[model samples]
Target: MKLTHWWPTALNPISNVAFLRPIDGGMKLAMLFQLAIAASAFSLHAIAAARPNIVLIYVDDLGFGDVSCNGAKAISTPNVDRLAARGLRFTDGHCTSATCTPSRYGMLTGEYPWRKKGTGVLPGDAGLIIEPGRATLASILQQSGYRTGVIGKWHLGLGDGTLNWNGKIAPGPLEIGFDECFLIPATGDRVPCVYVENHHVFGLDPNDPIQVDYKNPVGTEPTGREHPELLKMKLTHGHDFTIVNGISRIGYMSGGKSARWVDEDMADVITHRAVDFMERNQAQPFFLYFAYHDIHVPRVPHARFAGKSGMGPRGDAILEMDWCTGQVLDALERLQLTEKTLVIFTSDNGPVLDDGYVDDAVEKLGSHQPSGPYKGGKYSLYEGGTRVPFLVSWPGRIRAGESSALVCQIDFLASLGALTGTDLSQIKTAGDSQNVLPALLGESQIGRQELVEQGGGNQLALRSGNWKFLPAFAPKNAPAKARPLELFDLNQDPGETTNLASQYPERVNEMRQRLEQIQKNP
Candidate 1:
């Protein structure tokens, strides 16, 4: 009997066995009935086992309107466009925070980064932020038998307090749940400036160990500040401390010459690792967080992509990132994993031009708007800072369309947990990660009822439907900046230019109390 048609036959097994007992009367009828039930159960198990592999393509500092599908016309992002066209593109999706570290923490842990202290942008040497053995995205998926890995840009920090760069690095990604990890310790503009595979630095020569210090400069390396003539890229501000590969960085490092990664080859290198992960785990259900460092600070595209975009290094880097995305897409197609995989493409935060670099991003920008119609960028408490492009595609599983649901990156833990049949309630501590799986699967238009967005300085904003409230709060240790309580009806004023707090005092009060209540909770 066919397995698809065996379920109904197996449901009435006793009756069939009884009916056939009088006629042909043998143990064969009973055996057939058992076979049907066994086949049906096995079929169901097989269907459940065929969980789609997940690939989350996380880009660093890509804005809402950075791709053509999101209204960017100056430069084309064909690969990103293909992913968007094949999936559900979100119009109102957002990252949990407007920066890398906090957004990553919230996205993986399912908790508000602000709920925990010391989640701000971390230096390359900072201790591990996600407490070990915590219920994390990787842990949950790993429990469900999915091979998990995070490749590129892990700004969540590494090791416990005093990390020796040459020694084994623990309590990092592997401790958190990932089976394999290849990381740039912090951001591209920060230091130690080396690629880390598992625990040790990738290419460290034992003869000349490695040393990192955030406070003072170390070794005899030339810096953009001390040796201006030796620099290939000019520093605008804070990133002039330690120089590696002709670019000054935030912290200081010495030795590990062979391990230092080239800025221009970053895209290609990370792409290769991501593809390798996919190919290696092609037969198993794997979860890959393929984070890209392209289009971030020190926008240095590979030589082949140089001058391709008329805008400048920024635009050229975007094109280079698009090509990297194409490489992954092609890999999936070649491996025949396209239909068997769920791919999500999104950015860590909004866009910013002239972010401590003189890359001509501000001067060469023409009619292109990075944040689309929203206001502010990166560090500001504005829609453009937190709101980003979010797309989810799973062939034959999720229908393709544009969704206006208010979704967030923080929901991924619960959402994916639900997908893989994990009992989330038992795990308990998944702070604020709601299972909006229906909305994520393109089955419902509804998403989160409310969300909290954090900007640069632990400053927070609340979103409820079309209304957004930004309650005035004094800065922690700094002098007051005379900021007023603000409100905006996002449906009417998508730009957030007009503050209607004076008009609707009651709504502001209600949202403020609700925001305070959330913040006050354990």
Candidate 2:
């Protein structure tokens, strides 16, 4: 039970309720006794034998074309690229959902986010998405004796349906599985724009109470919709609420000025917290989910990386993320935990420039293709929306190779569970997850036989072997049109430019029937 705030000097501090004493001559002995007991209990709960450390580096809105390792030439990502060179690069890896909140739910629970109602895109004040009694990846990993911690983004709701910014919010990340947590309440562009460590909001000023609303403004905070002159980045759509760091966000907010995070230092802050958490738990097998808030909206890069990218704020933020990766890697090497640790790098969804801000992601584009020849961007049913750069590195443990295996990010929980000798007996929805450990290690080039995909736009596609089947459904968020039933041989045309529906009616009907069967189960 080690817990502490952003204290770099002290490093890992033991978390105990006994530290509440004012003056105690026998506190040291009591503390030591408690520590020993906790160690024993934690160890007993964990699996026998030493399990390899797990680190899942999740990035925000990073597309297949964002990383140098994934056919990206315009930007530099030496650290991520080098890691890809050391292990397996999964070209066909995908998140369950094409949006943030849903993808996170699927990734953590191994269940489709759509199964939970209204989990498409969560507002900051939304309640905890996962039920309180559910079994999460963090919970399972904790049972397997891993010290779990989550740093950065936590879009999965917190507290009950009603969250009070001033009061204590219970049953959050710590209750779910993470032994320790430092997180952004929801997003950099959302309301209650502050950080939370454990159960309390960090650096909250008592005199100045916090306030937030999405439907109606509090009439106190500056907004981009009415006060355009106060903003640095202009708005395009939904993100025209309260302004912070000269950028307007999605919802309204006020108070907690001192506690508000600096937009430019967001990357460094999250990276440092992750590195620090790893350093603290290096002695034990640990699971650190370092979710980076990069390449998302309000793309504010630090001064050093501000103009490094010619493609505008989106590209600039990516460079900053690359730098953060380098920093995390450097820390891992410095602590000598690289070989013993497992690193899985991936993105929540694909890319979308000009999502809401006027960061020049659309206007400044020259020859850069964010989706890499793919049809659609974020919030679409096209391959580019969910397909992203998925890489796993374990130094000498995993072989270095590029695999076109059809593995989903949701499979990681089961795959890693197998690595730690865990049986999914305690986990209820183990039905959705498949163990692909061999595929992840590059020992098997082939992966799942049939994988389903969700475009955040509400379109569904199924991939079985080399063929992809998309039934007759018009594209959402676009004009009405009767789309023909489609089936394409992906092996022949990876770009999915041509629809072979009319040519292969039999295959389309076969796949459509199979999809009905899979969807019917559970």
What lDDT would candidate 1 get against the real structure?
0.86
Report residue 516 deviation for candidate 2 (angstroms): 1.8
Top candidate (TM-score): 1
- lDDT string for model 1 (1-522, tens) is 222212121111101111122233346665786786577446434434677899999999999988999999898999999998899999999999999999999999989899999999998999999999899999999999999999999999898879999989887999999999999889999998899999888999988889899998788887777887877889788888878888898888899998999999998999999999999999999999999998899899999999998889999999998998899899999999999999999999999999898899988889999998899878877899989999999887778989999889998988787777676776656758877766787866878778899999689999988899987766657646536789999999999989999999999999999999889873
TM-scores of the candidates in the order shown: 0.90, 0.89
Screening candidate 2 with a backbone cut-off below 3 angstroms (N, C-alpha, C), the clashing residue pairs are 46-145, 128-157
Off by over 4 Å in 2: 1-48, 475-482
**Span of 10 residues, lowest total lDDT, candidate 2:** 7-16
lDDT of 2 by residue, 1-522 (tens): 433322111101111112232333365656775686577445423422548889999999998888888887777788899889988998889888788988888899888665567777888988888876677888888988999999999999888877777778766998888899999978888977789888988889978888888788885878888799999888878788888888888888898887889899988888889999988998999999999889888898998989889878889998888888888788889989888888999999988887877788988777777777666767877788888889999897778989988888877777777677776755667467776665777866756777778876456788898899987775566647446677878888878889898888788889999888877774
